[model samples]
Target: MTTTTHALAAPPDLGALYRRAVLSGLSGFLRRGGDLPNTTLELPAVTTDVEHLGAYARVCGFRLRDELPATYPHVLAFPLSVQLMADPSFPFPLPGLVHVRNQITQFRPLMVDEVFALRVRMADLRPHERGQQFDVVAEAVVAHQVVWRDVSTYLRRTGGRGGPRGDVRREAPEPSGLWRVPADVGLRYAAVSGDRNPIHLNRFAARAFGFPRAIAHGMWTKARCLTAFEGRLPDALLVDVHFRAPVPLPSRVAFSAHADASGWLFALHDPRRGKPHLTGSINLI
Candidate 1:
């Protein structure tokens, strides 16, 4: 496969990229191909803004610190992923793509002042039991070394069969904590994360997408789960999570975490229904 690369001087405006994504969704219906684009987008140098970082930390429940959180790089690279998925050559519409899974491997904790390069590409297009899935892989580099990487798997619901089922059945664990997720949590996170997906913003918008009410962003749940292990996690480690069900806005949810020899297993579930919302694990590297 021949890969084409495009490098930008700075990060693209996420607002503009989001507009393109919505327009692409409308044009996607006329698209007839089923092949993923073999392309990559890169930002040569990127650094964190202290205010932005603080706002993000507050929203995700992380303490403000010099060292960046494990999930922070994803925020930096997200616009590039949006650009890739919104391109005309891409196979899927960006608006409805569901982020079903995410894996982040941090080689070492990155500092707030460090400058890093970012590269994002699409890969691993395959079938799923309910739809087709692909990976948006992003990497953060400093001094020619990859310091952090993330693979976010998005599912495009196209109605397929005989593919692997992504769901895992597990009994709900005892609650370690209870959280009262506010109705505007999605909007708050979106303000910082640039993920203003309609399904997460307002009830009216969510209804257009077939959701009863606005839902929380999946990444927010993952970040919130990590907050429980803040200052306790290894510097170099892997965090993997599967989004099981959406957490509706203004809901009560339970969080559980168990530790063993290798690492920690964690999950967020609906306490009343005994249904899992997000299940994840962390492994020391």
Candidate 2:
């Protein structure tokens, strides 16, 4: 198989990306990876901004300190990943594809002024119990050294046969703390994260996309969970998350976490529905 590469002048604009995604729709998603060739997108090395990182920290409930947050690099590389997925040849619709899971590794604490190249590639398409799924690999490099990496698994629901049934674990205990998620959290997050998906921004926009109302960003939920574990996380760590359900805007939910031999196990669930919003673990490396 041949690999094709595109050099991006700068990060992609979500508006343009949305236009392309709508044009491709489900047809592109269903046929992705069957015979399509692999492709990668690369962006020139760029310096990080302290102010920008600080803004992200504020929204995600993290205090802005000297070092960048562990999850911040994901935000930096996400646009490039979107740019790859939005390609006409790529196999997935932008709005409907669910981010089922994410795995991120940080080798060390990244300072704000560090410069790094961003690369994103899509591959590993296969069957799932619910539908077909694929993995998008994103990396951040500092002076040719890999400093952080993320593998984002996305699902396109087509209800195909084969593969193991979704794993079911015992329900976690009731959360000890309750959180009142506001309606504008999506907008606030989008402002810093550069992920302005309309489904997460407003009820009207979410309805257009077949959701009852706007939903919170999955990364925000993950970041908030990590924030709660601040002063406890090791310098090198791995954060793995599986998004179980969507948390509608302006909703009240439960948050809980506990430390184990592996690291920290955490969860967010909606009290009203008695369903999990997301479940995740943090492991020291």
Candidate 3:
């Protein structure tokens, strides 16, 4: 399919994009379509903010360093993805979409001062048991070479015929460590990441969506896991994860991981109930 590209001269205004998302969500019922827009949004000559990177590291438990975390590119490319989804031609509202899975591939570690270009697009709309699912693909290109890429899968709840589940059941391993996730984690992460979804920021807002309280961002959980493997991961690698359940703020969760020749398998779970919050693996590329 032919794809149309929009080049942004400056970083997108996330606040404006979020306002559009809220309006789109409020009138989502009026939308009637299943097709994704065949368009790509590009932001060129992007550079990192040192202060913001430090803040992001603090919130996600990554040690401050000159090299960017594997998940960092997602943070940079997120605004483009938001712009693509907020377009009137997009089918689903951005507010209620569930982040069901994420897979990121880092060809090599990115340095803190390096400049890159970001490109984002939507693809692969398909049926799910409870709704429809689609992918938002983002890439970070440095000096004309693609250095990092990520595919974030989101589910939009609507009527649908049942489909096969992608997750596989596995026994929970013994805890390697325990984390006391703070209640303000969502707020802190949002300050740096620019993802201020109501379901992750306030109790009353979350209640409006049937959640008991605000939940931690899925990307935060993924980043925290990578933090645990810091200094041990390969320079080129792939991390794939399936989000299993919401982690209510101010909750305690257990983390576990086992290493092999290929890479590492890791998970975060409820310490008491043994219910997984996230399950994933990191493999050398």
Candidate 4:
């Protein structure tokens, strides 16, 4: 086993990356099971673009400010994380792997003018109720300090390997606010975020795989929830979200939030199905 590395002069081409991922998926499935090695890949440090950040902030309904959005680093690190997960050595097929949850922690507000190095690794392959799961860890380092971290958990529905059972948190409440999502929301977000995953782009593209319709990006959903927290959020905080169901394009959904002893508990759900699209908590660290 060897550590693979790439120094990107510019951001990755998501289309090409996905094609490669598809091929890797075919290879991994043929090999059955494998181990997730603890090798780290360091991507080139990138200087944030003010214009890009402003566009992302607007699309995600966040306030445009001097500081980068708390969820911005997760977007920056996504390409490398995808590469890590889709690498030929990865244990599971990329096509069926579900992004079940994401946890992000920001040590402090990061400025748009700063340059940060992104490091990505994978670990903790475990079992879930319906399948197997693992985590992709991404970190942002500015100067010599770690400024941000994101743990993205993905599930592959392959029965169970008897790994330890993960945490079991209480269910969030029914949503209090309703939102009508437009079909173009996914394309609009992809334009700014550089995530062109076909599953989120169009109905035809989505059905090419397995989804009945295009689904919203999990990160977009998380960002929108954070946007709602705006003024109430601390500069340093931790946000953990579990994605329960896909929010199909041109659909309506609901949102709810309440205060708990640890922090704020929030959820987005589909009223018709009585199922959560996402549930999360905000912990002030």
Candidate RMSDs in order: 2.0, 2.8, 1.9, 3.1
Query: Global lDDT for candidate 2?
Result: 0.81
Q: Write the per-residue lDDT of candidate 1 for residues 1-285, one digit (tens) a residue.
A: 888889998887888888888888888888765788888899988988999999999999999988999998898898888888888888877877889899999999899999888999989888777778899999999999999999999888877633223557555469999999999899999999988888999999889977899999999999999999987898899999999889999999999989968799899999898878898989999
lDDT string, candidate 2, 1-285, tens digits: 778787788888877887877776746636544532387778867678877887898888898876778888889888888887777666556666788888899888887777778888887888777777888898887888888889888887777543222344645666878988888889999998888888998889889867799999989989888888888888888998888888899899899888789898888998877778888888989
A best-first ranking of the candidates according to their TM-score comes to: 3, 1, 2, 4
Q: What is the TM-score of each candidate against the true structure?
A: 0.95, 0.90, 0.96, 0.89
User: Which pairs of residues collide in model 3?
Assistant: none
Question: Of the candidates shown, which would achieve the greatest lDDT relative to the real structure?
Answer: 3
Ranking by lDDT: 3, 1, 4, 2
Worst 10 residues of 1 by lDDT: 161-170
Give the range where candidate 2 is weakest over 10 consecutive residues by summed lDDT.
161-170
**What local distance difference test score does each model get?**
0.88, 0.81, 0.89, 0.81
For residue 170, what is the lDDT in candidate 3? Answer: 58
Give residue 236's error in model 4 in angstroms: 1.1
